[model samples]
Target chain A: MTERGLLIVLSGPSGVGKGTVRKAIFESEGTDFEYSISMTTRNMREGEVEGVDYFFRTREEFEELIAAGQMLEYAEYAGNYYGTPLTYVNDTLDQGKDVFLEIEVQGAMKVKEKVADGVFIFLTPPDLTELKSRIVGRGTDELSVIEERMEIAKAEIDMMSHYDYAVVNDKVELAVDRIKEIINSEHLRVARVIHRYIKMIKEL
Target chain B: MTERGLLIVLSGPSGVGKGTVRKAIFESEGTDFEYSISMTTRNMREGEVEGVDYFFRTREEFEELIAAGQMLEYAEYAGNYYGTPLTYVNDTLDQGKDVFLEIEVQGAMKVKEKVADGVFIFLTPPDLTELKSRIVGRGTDELSVIEERMEIAKAEIDMMSHYDYAVVNDKVELAVDRIKEIINSEHLRVARVIHRYIKMIKEL
Candidate 1:
């Protein structure tokens, strides 16, 4: 039997360019990873693709998924529901495709409780100054909101210890390369091949 | 301060071309790994460098090292003492140069006890048939001895579970590339970078 693909959970502090790195990796050649689409009650923004950006759902529909334990992890953010659908990820992994989940730290923690073997990677900016500049550079948040985000970023960076790997988002391409190397190297982990070898040994 | 270099322990069953791969990696451009020179009481063979191949020593000198805990791991083979000198490995790592220790599975296990965080990699052939052919190709052993070696290879392959990674030495360059990726990716592990980030976070 083929080994199951790695469940890669990519998370980082806000404004750390996690989304940019994820996009580059999926777009790059030789990466066969499936993006785990999240279910969200938020309205689709301009240029957002249905079922690609997110699986848009009504509040009651999301509530039903949560009640049935179908959502791997979910949260109510800004009066809207957002969650990862369990079936999509499980199906993709069952087909031997690596599934990438780009979630916030809190949702990642919840996902960890459900999938203990997931590869948890924390992406970070080179420094807090860079992170702050990126937050300010967004041009969408107010001064007070940016300050709050900086505080949250500090707390999130402290949680890097909980992750299996950390990739600094100094450059988007470099970060993507590091993540790709990490994914390739992890596939060579002896633990992943031990059971297969054991069966082969017994037959021998 | 520069991060301490990764202590890379490479082990595999005999006839798996572990030595060939190690030499190729050191010869490759941009690889700056230091080989951990072993101390041995055996007389130097023709063309072997005194400090490079093995630190040729008298039995008394070798014993002194073992007594003073200077030897990381050691074994007696064919009435001669052979061992890894602890100072060489620790000093190399302290200078931020990766140290490569190529030894048998038993010695690798011993070194793991002393250095709990070392990256242990097990190299193997593509399959048992290939392993058997390689063993026979050596041309020095009798039929019985060859059978004995095949049995040992099976036992050693079972120990792959204890290693952090396994690279099939199907092709020398491919094995080296996988190992390089493992080392590069390991440096990005969160556990390795957490303390540095923690200090930076404190200042921020």
Candidate 2:
């Protein structure tokens, strides 16, 4: 039987560049993980493919999945539901293909509750000042909103204690390299790969 | 206070190329670990630097150190003493510099008993058949000796359960890369690094 693959979850506080870092990882030439497409109840935007962008579903369908416990983790934001489909993630992992999930901190926590063995990586900023600057650099939010975001970011950073690894997103490429290394080493861990060696010795 | 650096131990059964792989790692441009120079009572060979090659010591000095519990691990071989000095390893780590020890399987076990947190990596050949060929390829051992070595190797391979990682030495460069990745990932482990983030959050 093929060994199951790792479930890697990339998450962080708002404006920590989780999306940007995830994009860089997927765009890199060496990434072998299967990006898990999230299911959302939001309308499809312009130039967005049906499955490529997201598995867009109607609000009723999304709630039905949630009610039936088919979603690995889901959250309601601005009256819309966003979640990871449990079936796809489990199926991909069982086929020995790593699954990559990029989500919000709250959603990631929910995933942690169900999949205790998943590699939960908290992408942090260099410092709180830098994180505040990144939030303000967006130039869209008002001062009050930015301040609220900073407060939320502080709380989320506190939640980093629950993560398996805390990678500082000083640069996208560097963060991606660290995450890749973590995955490679996790595969080599004795708990994960020792069974094969034990079998080899038995055969010998 | 600086975080204590990890004590990385690379070991394997006979004919597994542990020395070659360790040498490649140390010679690599990015190696930052301090190679723990072992102290031996054997005579210094020609062209060998006193401290660089091995810390040459008289048998009396070696015995005194061993009696004082200064030797991290030691063994008597060919009527000579060879062992790692605990003072150097502890001082280097206290300075926040990593110490890399490449030794035999038995020696690694002894080190493990003393340094419980050390990263013990077991380097293995691709297969038993390949391992046998490598041992016989030496051309100096008799058939009976080769058979005896093979039996010893099997027992050592069984000790892999005590290690943190088991890397297959299929190619030296690939094995080195894997070891590097292991070290990188080990540095990012939440248990080892979360305190820094906790301090950061407190300051924020």
| Top DockQ prediction, candidate number | 1
Q: Worst lDDT window (10 residues) for model 1 chain B? A: B74-83
Evaluated at residue A83, the lDDT of candidate 1 is 88
Residue clash pairs of candidate 1: none
B90-141: candidate 1 lDDT, tens digit per residue = 8889998889988778778888888889999999888877887888888777
**lDDT top scorer:** 2
Model 2's CAPRI class?
Answer: medium
Candidate 2 structure quality by residue, lDDT tens digits, A60-109: 99989989989999987546788999999999999999999998787899
Worst-scoring 10-residue span by lDDT in model 1 chain A: A195-204
Residue B105: error of model 2 in Å?
1.9
| Model 2 stretches astray by more than 4 angstroms | A41-50, A77-80, A142-144, B40-50, B56-60, B75-82
**Model 2 Cα lDDT, one tens digit per residue, B58-161:** 99999999899998998765467778999999999999999999877877889999999898999999998898898889778789988887787888899999
Q: What are the candidates' interface root-mean-square deviations? A: 1.0, 1.3
